[model samples]
Target: MIGFVEQLLRFASHIPTFHLNVQLLVDFAATCEAQLDRWGILEDVDIAIHYISEIVTNTSNGDHDKLQLALSSLYRERAIYFGALDDLKSATEHGPKPQALNDTKHTSWPSKAIHAGRTYLAHGILLKDTVKAQGYLNKATDLFEKVIAIGSGNIALLVYVCESLAWMCELGHDAGAEPRLRRHLGSYLLTDILDQQNNPRVSTGKHIGRIGFCYLCLFKKGSNQKDLENSIKYYNIVMNSKAIDKRHPCRCALLIGLGHAYLYKKQDKWAAHCFKTATLLEFAIPALRMDACFSWAKVPNIDLVEVYSNALKIAPQLAGLEYALSHRVDNAKLLKNLVQEATKAAIAGNDISLALMWAEQGRGIIVAQMLQLRIMFTHPGIPIIQHKEPELADSLRRATTSLHQLDALMGTMDVKSTRKLHRDGVRWNHLVRKIRASEKAQLGDFLCLSIEKILQLGRKRIIVIINAHGDGWDALMIRKGDNRPQHISLPTSNERFSSLRKDLFNAGLRERRSGDGASGTTGSDNTSKVKGRAVKKIGAQPPPPPTPDSILKIILVQLWNEVVHPILQELGISVSTILP
Candidate 1:
């Protein structure tokens, strides 16, 4: 009977299309019914009936798209069924259930609520219907409250419910939801999960990092110094521990969170160090790097705008007025122009949704501009003085001030507080610090620099010489007035050399031949007897002495070897030098 059920599931799993296979589902239901009858297990019969009913309801409509959705719904149902079945089988065969499961009280209300809420949320998103989505989210919230009322103290279940509520609140900021989210989170104390002597989860630093994250989030909400301290403490524990797992998401999040917290406290140096550590953690685990956009917005750019705008309210910069007017052509000015264009587009469209989307995109562009300014100001290696292009700097400062003012005015609707602004500021500072400390140190710096320089100096200009050989024979040349280096060819008896010479000439390099019919003179005939005798005694033929052409080649080769090679090496170009 077990083998028959496994075969049925295996067949169901292999359906090529997501559309519900009604015939296959019916077969499965029949098989389950037969098995239930044979075993006469009342619980199994009840479960099978529930599954069949849900599956039938889902597939009743039978449009291909609806069928596909139904199939997806069934997938989750099957997962829950499999889990339940495994539990039942284990109870029958083994001595007892795991202690954690044994301790967890079964609450059907919460389980039913979670399942229905998930279905509604999925349908809301799939249909892109905001009203329906909110309805489902409300249902989910109600279910979560019922679970809390049951008072089972199931940490996993509570965490999952709280996270879901937090996500729903974030989807569209519902002011009423904040208190509830906080109340749910407050239930878990430090001692609830942590072991007495050491953190049981931190067998290898990953769990310690996760524990730190939980603390960091708590610190953000409650302003608890102990939570922040414990976060950093656990971070240090992970960093110092030799058993660090490179793939751990917890480690990456903890490092990033630590960096943001330190930045919030105005400890710029410490914040930068934390950010640098976070960046390294991201490299070790690339999935974490996507959080950069969110992290960068927290500190120097967004918060700086808030701080400067508040300051500007009392003390308007007369100097900034003159500067902004003079540099009306810069990026800040350009961004303002784009925003105006976007606003015009919105007004013309006459659709509120389109207008809101355009306005949001425009805001993003403005934020990007702010990020660029913050990057210029705070990046460690780029000496701040170098950014002293008076007009451009003035424009950036004005723009920053202007954006802050805009944010404040907008704050009547979306008012961000000083604390939130400060938190964001610290986060940005940390990110800058982490980027600087990356393993590919110079590579990171170069990448951050203006795109033009990256395209120009960093790109390699290869000069391959055909048939050139010897310790000093020059195979490549870059003329004083030329934009790129040129290749040169030396005389050779082989057909490969003949083809190579043609290739070099085609590639814009000078080609000259030696011997009677060639353009250049033969130097073998000019070898001195004394030098030839010395070469002969050493059992080696003397190399042909330099002619005017050869001397030019030698000088050009020497110039490249001494000058270009070092520059290329410093730029991290891993190309081999062409030798003659």
Candidate 2:
């Protein structure tokens, strides 16, 4: 009889007709009453009556159509179970019934409430109505509380309640329903959920990644360094686990998270390495293709462009010269492609800021190439005023103007002050200043000084550290050498003065390794040692490279010759040697 009741309930749950199920349940209730009468089991008969009454009351009052369906199904299943149990009770009333049959009386109002509440919650999610969904969740929680009050040690019920709350918090964040969701996280025994003993559900690497990410989000909301550290700790655990296959979704998020953490902490090189590594891994995974399309569409390929640009900017000697000579044409083409990709993404995302940033970064690259070209072709000793080619001067003027406009647009874009993002902004700002200083020379000297001052003072005001590409050398001390001043600081040192300076040397090396360019690696330790010896060797040697005046002339001449000339050629503008 017990086995028959169990089978009947299982079958009723899968049935299609709510009304038929209810009718079947009503007939089964009648059968139970008859068996109880024959056996004289009054207590068993009374319990079955209450269960039937509760189901009927809830079903009749249910607000939604789906609730009506669920109530009818439950009514049918309840009828079958109660009828069979009543039969067994009648047969055993003369003696003792089985424990299962005896326990049937305990499943009463609370069980019905829980089932109904859960049904409502599921329907709400299906309807995509958050407010209605939360209302149903409240109902479910109330039912769960009732069960607990009645001392029901149903682990499944407890787990279900906890899982519901956790999801509520996550969804609430996505819906912009709350500013912080961590407060609700404590409601769930997440640790216990992950525990194999308490949870029969399988744990996946993605689950671990979610736990880590939740913690990371909490840390981001506050300045709790410990929470941030713990976030990284959990990420490491998941990444190191055997469950974390390269093909897993968790791998890409974990990599991106680690990169972000490093970047936020002002670890640019490490952050770049992580970002690059994650990009490679993400590209390999077919599932992440959409994510890649979205992310790459937002930002320009500045990281790659900067890697090469900074290489030439810093060390005009050695392979830097050769790299600039060979890659300028190809690099310009790549930058154009990146701009197109970014434009497409911007249009797709409807993000005006991202579109502008990408556009400016692309323009910056073109300007940078022009600057490089001017250095290559312009007569070594001539000033702009003395240059015989009027076309060259005009091209230089036009490129400088374009660069200024690009700078202004980039500067006005809304960039988050994350370490990487801010650093990128700062690098662009510095490039702008450099361009302005190069174009107007003495005329822009005051503005250049003001920019430097702003940067120096801006340090204290910066609230977030962002990963800004390029050598990020605005704060580095300039050492005079040859025609251009040499950068005298190492990148990534914790020293207050040198911290923001990223190694153009290592950036070039990685760019080459990633097949972007030829290697222009500068061993920092070796360079430092060599510099120390050189300074000692020439304690009071000839005065350092010419004052800022000579440097300015050289920069202006280079900008006019390289950037402006090519742009004019592309635009079909005739060039002539004449003073503006």
Q: What is the lDDT for 412 in model 2?
A: 57
Cα miss at 356, model 2 (Å)? 21
Tens digits of per-residue lDDT for model 2, 326-411? 33354455445445444334434554333333444444554543344344235332254225434444554454454444445655
Q: What is the lDDT of candidate 2?
A: 0.40
Query: Which consecutive 10 residues in model 2 have the weakest lDDT in total?
Result: 473-482
**Candidate 2, RMSD to the unseen true structure:** 30.1
Model 2 residue 571 lDDT? 35
Please report, in order, the local distance difference test score of every candidate based on alpha carbons: 0.42, 0.40
Clashing pairs in 1: 263-426, 275-434, 276-434, 298-424, 298-425, 299-424, 299-425, 470-580
Q: Candidate 1 overall Cα lDDT vs. reference? A: 0.42
Which runs of model 2 end up more than 4 angstroms from their true locations?
A: 1-189, 192-202, 282-302, 306-580
Q: How big is the positional error of residue 107 in model 2, measured in Å on the Cα after superposition? A: 10
